[model samples]
Every structure is written in C-alpha cells, then in structure tokens.
Target: MDKDLNSIVQKALLGDKKALESVVEEVKDLIYNLSLKMLLFPEDAQDATQEILVRIITHLSTFQGKSTFKTWVYKVATNYLLTEKSKKDRKAKEVSFDEYANQIDTGQSAMIRYTNNEGEIGLLEEEVKVSCTHGLLHCLNPANRLIYVLGDVLDLNSKEAAEILEITPSSFRKQLSRSRERIKNFLTAKCGLVNPNNSCRCKRKIDFLIDSKMIDPHALRFANHTKRSIDMMQKIEFLDKTLSVFRSVPIIGAPNGIMKEVRQTINSITF
Candidate 1:
C-alpha cells in the first residue's frame, strides 16, 4: 500500500464515508481478478468480489497494519474463497488430465467450415486458448489452483504469497512448484501453443467449442482484452518456457456496473 491508500484506510476507519468508498475503488480490481481466477466464472467472480469487499469493510478495524493493506486484502479474499460453501456448490465438474486430453483429441478430425478470414480465426483461437487454459486450472484442487494463480499468474513472491495463504514460505514454494510442473507437463503434452508438434491447437478447437456452445463468437470472454496477464507480470528467472502460454491469457476487467452495486451495498451497511 502507498501513502495515499494508507491515509484513505485511516480515514475510512474513522467513519469517513467517501474514504470507505475510496477503499472499495482501490481494492476492487485486485479482489475481482483474484475471484475470477479462483472461481473461473465472471458471474461467480462478481458475486464473490462483492461479498469479499463487504467483508473487508465490515472487518476494516481488524486490520492491524502488520502487512501492506494489499496483502491484508488478499488474506481476506483468499480466506473467503477457501472456506465459502457456495464455491463448492457452484464449481464446475472436475476434469482429470486424461479426460481433458481425451476431450481435445476427440474433436481433432472436425473441419473448420465456419470462417476463413484470418483475423476472425485468430480471435476465435485466442478465445479457445484462454478458455481451455482456465479450465485446466480446475484439474487442480482449489488449494493448488490458488497456489498457482498467486505464485505464477499473479507473480507474487513466495514470502508474500505464503503470508497471504497462511503457510510457510517453503511450503508455498513446494506447492507452487508442483502446480507449475503439473500444468507445464499437461500443456507441453497437449497444447500446440506450448508445443508445436502437439495436435491440440486453439484454432482446431474453435469450431468444436462454437458448435458445442462452449464459446460464443459474438460475446468473447477472454479474447477481447488488449492486455494479457504477461504485460503486468515481472519475468520469473528460470521459468519454464512452456508456462509462457498461461501468461498469454488476457487479463479481464471486472464486469461493468460492479462498482455501482458495491456503492449501493455499502450504503445499506451502518459502518
């Protein structure tokens, strides 16, 4: 946290209504993006973001200044995501590496009769790549998924991520390493983006995904963004080149109108 946000937090704690709203504005993107990665759905991410923001406001006084406010916010968000009952209730069915590989392999013979324009094809391919990689994260249990998202995608250092996760830095590093290796192995074996010889190209999957209604050509979820997650990340030394495929995933903004909803919800609360 910077001096401005720290000062805002102080004012918010003193019953400054504008400062409270400022706090929400400042942290909403972090909370929202983390929720999206954890939940793998925009609607669920939005709902969880709202709930987490409310929790932060309700517990603002509990912040002891032991860590940066950003880290503290991460602690609150991760705790809710880890323990929330509805997360399990709403989670998509888990797919194993074998099952996913089979799914990709099953549709390889299909022809791309939909579009021939190179630009449109590229967009659809991007959608497939982003959607497929996000789905891959579900193969890991929630804990490991969170570990990967925090350590690799968000590029948080081991000590900070460990503090956020309430684990020792060594344990965090161990789990993150395992998660990275698992994802890297799977991608290298199956994804053309990571391995040129792999048969599972994003362009190859575009037709099947569209035909099956897994992707909407008009309403793309991940491909429309101008900035990828990699643009915001600092390069990790000795990272496997294969994992760069994940870093290519687009960084999506929180859904529109979320701040309005948050403001309304804040108004309803006494504090």
Candidate 2:
C-alpha cells in the first residue's frame, strides 16, 4: 500500500466515517471483480461483494498492518469465497476428458465460420472466449480454482498467494502447477483455438446459443458497456507463451450500480 492508502486505513480503523467511506469506495472494484470471478453470476457476485465489504468493515480493527491492506483484503475475500464454495448447491460442474472432447467434435468435416461484416460474430467470439475460459475454471475443485485465479488469472506471485491462502509457498506452487497442467492438458487435447487437432469453434456455438435462448444479442451481459475489455493476454504477458490462450481470454467485472449500493451500506454503519 502507498502512504495515502495506509493513512486511510489508519483513519478508517480509528472511526473516521469519511475515511471508512473512502476505503469502501477505493476497494469496491477489487472486491466486486474477485467475487464475480469466484461466483460466476451477477446476482451471486453482488451478494458476495456486499457481504465482503461488510466483513472488511467489521474486521478492520483486527488488521495488524504487517502486510499491506490490499493483501489483507484479498485474504478475507478468498476465505469467504472458499467457505461459500464448500456450501451445498455450489458444487462446480466436473468435466472429464471424454466429456470435454465430446463438446469439441464438430461432427462434420467443416466447422462453422462467421464473417466479421455482420459485427455480431465479434461479440459472440468475445463472449465465447470469456465464458469458455471461465467455464474451464469450474472443472477444478475450489482450492485449485483459487490457486489458478490467484496465481494465473490475477497474476499474483507464489509468495503473495501463499500468504493470502495461508499455505506454504511450496504447497501453493505445487497446487498452482498442478492446476495449470490440468487446464493446459485439457485445452491442448480439446480446444481448437488452442490445438490444431481439435475442431471446435466459437463461431459454431453462436448460432446454437442464440437459438437456445442462452444469449441475447440485444443485451450482452459480459462483452458490452465496459470502458475496457479485460484482455488477459496483456495482463498476463509475463507468463509462459505456450499458455497464452488462457491469458488471451478475459475476466468480466462487476456490473454497474453495485458499487454505489455497497458503499452506501458500508458508510451507513457506525463503525
């Protein structure tokens, strides 16, 4: 944390209402984005974000400042998400290699292709890239998912991630390596975008998705209305180039109005 943020934390812990409000405003996006990635649904993300903000406020005094406030906040957010994942109805879809391969087979000799002149193809590809990559995360257990998110998606170092996860650095690295290997093997064996042997194409899925009423072009939830696209390629450039496909995918952020409400709820509190 910078000196300015450190000062805000001190004031917030000391019962400065404005400072507390400022803290909420400053970290709202971080909390919301993390929750959105973990929960993978807008409504669930909204609820998790609100709960996380309240937890941060409620536990502000327990912060020892041995680590940066941002690190502490991430630890809190991770613990909550892991706990929520353990609850019933939160079980992630398990995709076996056979099942994954079945989804990638185009059936016919040629896979469907779309032209850029229509404009909708680009939007569809954007959605496919984001959704497909995020979907892959769900195939892993919650612990492995957290490791992948912290180590690869969010690009935190092993030491930092281990600290946040409260695990040994070696243990964190081992889990992260296994998670990467599992995802890489699956992608290489199945996804055409990642491997030449695979025939699956995002363009082909667009028609099926639209016909099935899974995606509405009129109101695209993941790809539109954002100031900037979350290009994981640019963000994770420091990683191995062979795993660039995962890095090229995007992670959607929280929708609008959530931040304002969360901040208000935090500011209204006496603490």
Candidate 3:
C-alpha cells in the first residue's frame, strides 16, 4: 500500500486527476480493509472508504509530506470510522460480546496477527483466534485498536504507526502498551488464557516490588484477602467461555468504506 501511494500522491497533488484516481484505486483495498476491521459492516465500511478517498482528494493540497501519503489516507479512513462508531454508540446502548459476534457478518476473511520471535509458546491456533476477536472488540470503540493492529499485527514501525494515528511515536507506543494490556485483560477474562509467561512475568514483577518493599504489603493483602472478589477459578472459566465465542464466531473479516464515501460526498470539494 505504501509502495502504491508514493507516485500517486505526488502526481495527484500536482493536479493529475488520473493520478489521484489511480492512488485511490491502489489504496482503496487497504482503506476498505482497515475500515471493515474498524467498522465491521460492509455498508459502513464502504461509506467510510469512499468518504476517505474524497477527503484525501480535498486534503491533497495540505498534505505537506510530513508523512507518507498512505499514512495520511489511513488517518482519514480510521478517523472517520471512529467518529461514526462513536456517534452510533452515543445514540444507544453498546452491544455485548455475543451481540458483536452474532450481529457481525464475516465472509471468510481473517485478521492478520503478529507473532513474537519467542514463537507460539503456549498460544495455540485457537488461542490466537480468540485473542484477535477479543482484541478487535477491545479496539472498536477507540481508534487505538486499529493502531495496534497496524503496529503490532502488521509489524509496522512505530514511526509508520504514529503517522497513521497522527500521534507522536512515543505516544503511539504508550497507547499501544495500554491497548495491549487492555486486550490481554479482555482475553484473560474471556478465554481463561493465563499466558503463563506474561502472567508469571507480571507476577514476578509484582513480587519483586513486594520483596524490595516497593509496594505496600498491606494493600496487596487487602486486594487478595480482604475484599470479596471474583475468584481466580471463576475468572479463568469466564475467559475460556469468552474465548470460545471467537472460535464459534470468527473475527477479522472485511473492511467498510460507506462512511468514507459519505464524507467525501457531503464535504466541500477541494483540490
């Protein structure tokens, strides 16, 4: 997609309609793919894609080349999709996980996942599927999820991900870490995914702080022994069921561009 956007953006900005059209053609697939990942509905995704293209055309003049054209275009597509999602959520109660699975339409496409060189370890194919679905939903509300998908799953560099999100690279990393924790928590609760390495790693860190007297042992005691809380066993069982939903439902199918089209259509035309 980046390869496709280069000359197209340069030529399009130079007042070449054909070049601009070609650029759209090149990135339309990407725009829509990401949109569908973000929006999860073909109609919504299509609108978002079309609207993004129009915006790209309008903003061509303002694209100062601070980032690649693909980055700018991605921001356009994702930002619009996020806005539409927020608007809809504000209008009504949000969907539950089951609702998300049952209501969503998957035409056999899968979300690309990222793997660490540490290898699969405890994560099996089924685990990946559950994690992806849970992660996508975790990210659907904030555009941050898409950013992680681009950065983590796609293995895009921080600068590239930052460019797409319109945030500083450092900021992108921070949010990405938070997003990772968020998805992990979501999955842990949904799939009984202990992620022994990661969990034990966290436990070790916590223990280190305790042994070093960095944390208040009293607080730890209260959190674990004093307050009534969901037992670890129950939590694991809950997450296992949650993870099961993805195996049954599937995630990472198609992208939407409907909002993109609408934005393009409704906005004032610009060169």
All candidates: CA RMSD (Å): 2.8, 3.3, 16.5
Q: Residue-wise lDDT of candidate 1 within 1-271, one digit each (tens)?
A: 5789999999998888899999998898888888877777777888888888889988999999999999999999999988983445466566788888888786664457779897787777777777787888888888999999999988899999999999999999999999888888888888775677887767778777888898999988777763443332235333565667666555566676778877886687676
Return the number of clashes found in candidate 3.
Answer: 30
Segments in model 1 whose C-alpha atoms lie over 4 Å from true places: 85-88, 109-111, 226-239
Assess every candidate by TM-score.
0.89, 0.84, 0.53
C-alpha positional error of residue 85 in candidate 2 after TM-score superposition, expressed in Å? 5.1
Candidate with better lDDT, 1 vs 2: 1
Which pairs, if any, clash in model 2?
233-247
Better of 2 and 3 by TM-score: 2
Tens-digit lDDT track of model 3 for 150-239: 765455788888877778999888877876666556545433234433222212223333344533434331122111221222333333
Question: For this target, which candidate reaches the highest TM-score against the unseen true structure?
Answer: 1
Top model number, lDDT:
1
List the candidates ranked by TM-score, beginning with the highest: 1, 2, 3
The true-versus-predicted C-alpha distance at residue 155 of model 1, in Å, is: 0.9
lDDT of each: 0.80, 0.71, 0.52
Q: Where does candidate 2 stray beyond 4 Å?
A: 88-92, 106-117, 225-242, 249-253
- After superposing all C-alphas onto the true structure, candidate 1 shows an RMSD in angstroms of 2.8
RMSD of 2: 3.3
lDDT of 2 by residue, 1-271 (tens): 4678889989988888788878877787788767766666556777787778888888888999999888899999988888853473363465665665565453422333434454566776566655666667777877888899889878889999999999999999999999888888887777666665666666667666666565676767566643223344445554354366655544445556666766666667775
Rank by lDDT, highest first.
1, 2, 3
Task: Supply the global lDDT for candidate 2.
Answer: 0.71
